[model samples]
Target: MKGQENKEEKMECKKEENLVSCLCTYYSCSRKGVCCDCIRYHLKSRQLPGCCFSRDAEATYDRSFEHFARLVQEGKV
Candidate 1:
């Protein structure tokens, strides 16, 4: 029981660390590290969050879900 709880806590901590690592940092947006906040910030402007794109696409600042979808459809993702 306690062992399982410890393992679960460890997993949760790792997940948080991974989220921090996945932050979209190429832009000056205030929603850099928080995924939900980032998504909301972009969606408010009719844009997609950076995690929706490939590294190349994200670097280009093309935060459009349509563009990301196109990339995936075209096998570029």
Candidate 2:
């Protein structure tokens, strides 16, 4: 039980640290500061996380590989 509690505490600390550097613009996502969860969720949907996109591109909410390609071509990614 103590070990589990310690693990939970460590996770919380990491989350707090991650929040400081996370650039995801979504305000209500449960995985906002949790990179692993966000990546897994997006990958399952054949998309990438918001942080992978540029500010303007990310604002469009089009996280598809196709969009990324466009951004890359436009030198925005």
| Candidate 2 per-residue C-alpha lDDT over 26-54 given as tens digits, one digit per residue, 9 for 90 to 100 | 88999988888999999998899988887
Say which candidate scores most in TM-score. 2
- Quote the lDDT for 40 in model 2: 95
CA lDDT scores, all candidates in order: 0.70, 0.83
Overlapping backbone residue pairs in candidate 1 total: 0
Alpha-carbon TM-score of each model against the true structure: 0.62, 0.75
Per-residue lDDT of 72 in model 2? 90
State the lDDT at 59 in candidate 2. 86
